[model samples]
Target: MGRPPGAGAEGTWESALAAHLAFRGAVLDVAGSTRRLSGELSRLGESHWGIAGKAAGLFVPHVEYGQSQLRWIDDELAAATRLAHAAAEVEDPDMQLALLRLAGPRLEAAMMGSMLLAVWFDFLNLTDATLSRHLYSVETLYVKMERWQKMLEPSMSALASLEPEQVESAAEDMPALVGHLTREFASLLDTIHKGAKVLETALVLKESMEALTMLSALRFSLPAMRPALPATLGVGLMVGPNGVMMGTRIVVSAEWVEMMRQLVRAGVLSLPAVSAAVRIQAGHVMMAQGHGDLPRGVRDALGDAPEVRAMRVTGKSGAGMAEPPRHHVMPNEFREWFEKRGFTGKMRIDWFCVTLQQPHHQAIHGGGNWKLGRKWRGEWNQMIMKALRDAEVGAGRMLTQNEILKIVAGYMKLYDIPMNFVRCRGK
Candidate 1:
């Protein structure tokens, strides 16, 4: 179809109202669905490994990557809502028309002028989606399929050694169950790929407000047209541009449920970094002793392993080099604030600390060369605090350690911090 007059110029009150509702609905839907999946993952991971344990730490991330994306969507929604309210409801249809005719141009201008395209761009979020996978890590199955298959090899071997009864106690068929999960992971990736096709198409349409122009045409034309005309084409074009949400939890969580159950049955129940290193050297015989915690010393030699989380360094080494300072990931100044909201005595402000590369640390705290007092809430901390506050309000409860870490991950990615620099939970 040919382009409409005033394309990208200004949407009608109808289109603006539709865009406001549709855009906000779509953003919340994607973010909300992602949040739901994050919990599903948290449950599966922490159920076996403890919330503060290694399963949660493998990614040091996971759903945490979405924290900022969720908050960013929210900020855009808030702005859109305020702008939409300018075209608020009234008792009379005639009065509503009069308001639109009089103020609609300015209101639409305000909405578009406010860089509302950012909301659409974020919705597309091709780059943001990739980070979600890497930090969010469900895509560990899909993207790191080879790595996952390799990791599962031990669990598979461990399961194979068991008697039929031992396997039956947890899994119906050992190899078959593992095969099912691998297939499901592939299927899940296929589903995402299908959704990506939709996203890619929308991204093309989004250039120069072409999608908005289509929405404007639909606002006037759809109701009067035949019912079977695919009315969803226009307004919905903008809603779920990324196609990354909805029922995703079902697939991702299902994969986790089976994988964890299989691992437990196989006696391959060691953590990825710490305990795995200790017990794997102790070998499979340690699995026979019971799944209780190992002694701290058998694990001490294991800390040097690369998967061991990076620690916050302090002061100087025996060599007298000035170590990069360890700073609290959640600023220490707000300890009381976080404590009140479940940062807790046990979760420990120290556990949340990161020792950034000195240059990055100095950059974060104002600058390396400039005379500096550092950014408010450490600058990074301020936005993180705001995002977490918004999350608590959205989630309707105090955030979990896992949840807080996810938010921090999201913000760190925003600052372009390297993933290796992220100081994980549980030291």
Candidate 2:
């Protein structure tokens, strides 16, 4: 007589048991890395610099949270390892299948926990390095610090919502439950990865802007010195190698013009710069206390030109004595701009990527074909089928019809999978 519907194939079950053992070994390596990172962070926290000291203190809570999760994962992995070894020695298909089912959730929880912990570990390390290198007094650095902290909120919220207990409770079919947990955990990891990238990009931009602001100030001030200081600051800003001519009209590149417009649209340029530009274009100064009035004055002054058009003409042309644009944003406008981009949204991986690479893409589709290529689609489908087969073998049994469908649905949600492909076939 044929075996029961959920019965395991002997060779496949054995191979599955072996795979679990290998996975347990891999988890052990992750545990070692986590421990080392935790130790390194602890050492860094003992440093003496005030800023580093403050940042280290703030980072403690996140490290503690990660450590706690790591401990839980370690326990789960230890237990799973024990169960896998016992299953490997077993001859009965039913007994081995039962052991595999029991180990599944523990393994899933450990894997998810490890991934979440790694995200925090990486964030802490990056924050520490950034804080150590730059002073917080600089406006760009301060803004970068604030942005990093704000970005952590969503990640922390996601981490807190991770319910490993749910994994155990909901996992009726081991393979399907493992698949579901894998998808959910992967989605969370991707979110955290994108968030980290955003923070990194912010830091880079902050550093660049700080240098630009300093050089621009020096460029304007140095030339006005009594003896006229050497034109060191004019190296990049000046149109000629001889350095800037005091009363000569300055010329700017088309690229510089485009960049100023983008910076204005992003709300990163200072209100004072906008005000000064408006004054220059309109031939009269406006006493504006806030950004609302500044943008209006600018619009009226420039008339149909881009909001930042004055900036292109301000410092670059006409005697090189024009006021250079400041790199600070008005607080209210920055907050509004941030919110409009849905920075607080639950699934912000797409938003985060767009913000880091092309801020303009947030409001509109960044001009790309949405259709998947036929070859790419075929490759994706094959990969999915392979994953499903491996999952079944690792679980030591054929997944139920409902369990298979649920796994498919989880993949669909996780990847926004297209419906045009053939349904996944099961062994």
Candidate 3:
């Protein structure tokens, strides 16, 4: 197609809008992914390994990244629209070019503005959860110490009331009661100290996670796009009377790059600092209120009864004292159906890889793989029971990660065969 005069001045605004829309969609998807990942982490508990570990730490960062991107997109879109409208109103080529140049850095600033918001939102929930867990530990210590105080009050009262002859009997019991009280006090102090330490550790983790979040946001975002004047036929035609061809290179302003770099660095430093503060607050809360919030029965039992005390302290340190095992959610017929359909080997592995990497794409394949994995992991114990009930999968063999992957792949292949597969978007 032959170049139309002043075509660059006319179509630049339309092209900018299209590019911004594409960026907007991608940012929203990233935001959604962050949300989904956060929810998954919250559900999995702090103890669950793999993505859950990363998630516990990344929640704030994820939100921050998303928020930053979203804000940038919104601002960029608004500026682009205004510029387009302004361009529509302008008849002068020089004036239109001036408008484009002014809008360039503004668009870039809009794009980068989202980084702060992204960091703030990404890990907020995960950090909150960590704080909650720390506080819960402190509450436990408070309960222990409160019960000890109550027990000592009664002993102290009885010792004060005893008569001379009864003093002998009282004296004998006195040693035991004093010893019990001393032991209880020491135990309470120990628990308080331990809880404090845990709070400290959690604070550190939160700090580092926050720092990471900031770094990711600042370093990876788009910088401002500078407008460049076309340097070809126009300049040559203008200089024709002087018998000379002229050209100029469009250079993006140095200020724009420097501003972006600074913003990113500032975000990186600030996020960790904010997270550290949150952790410090949480730790203080945990240390001040150890075990105070536990059920009354549990508290009383800790101080008054030797058996209960042993169970609380000793059992806590032992392997048998752990929380009940979680169950999985896989079904009986799922494996059988897959085997019946001859789903195996490379096909299964390839699908598993795809589903793991591109969950959205797998969803289009009726997404049975993701659905099964979600069902299994969502409420683990129920899934285990269901698996146990099935003879083929249940036989003496426990489910492995590979088995789970296979099941997901098979389910995907079985139900999603007819759906057209769309390749994943973005690099």
Top candidate on lDDT is 2
lDDT agreement with native, every candidate: 0.36, 0.37, 0.31
TM-score of predicted structure 3: 0.22
Can you tell me which runs of candidate 1 are displaced by over 4 Å?
Answer: 1-320, 367-378, 393-397, 416-427
Error of 1 at 377 (Å): 9.1
Between prediction 1 and prediction 3, the one with superior TM-score is 1
**Candidate 1 C-alpha lDDT tens digits along 11-76:** 333433433343334334334533543344344333333222334444334223333333433443
Model 1: residue 208 alpha-carbon error in angstroms: 88
Give the better candidate number (1 or 2) by TM-score. 2
Show where candidate 2 strays beyond 4 Å. Answer: 1-13, 48-52, 137-427
Assess every candidate by TM-score: 0.26, 0.32, 0.22
lDDT of 2 at 427: 4
Give per-residue CA lDDT, model 2, range 1-427, as digits (tens).
1233564476645444444444445446446755665675465456444223653355455445556665666666676566556445554433443344444445544544454344345444444544554423334434543554454344333323322234322221222222232333233223323444455554553453234322111122222212121112222222232221121224222322233233333222222332332222221112112223434323432232455343221212146454222211112223333344332332111211101112221111221222432234423344445555677788887654333333443454344332111101110
Q: Rank the candidates by TM-score, best first.
A: 2, 1, 3
Off by over 4 Å in 3: 1-76, 81-93, 102-105, 122-126, 135-427
User: Residue 103 in candidate 2 has what lDDT?
Assistant: 49
lDDT of 2 at 358: 26
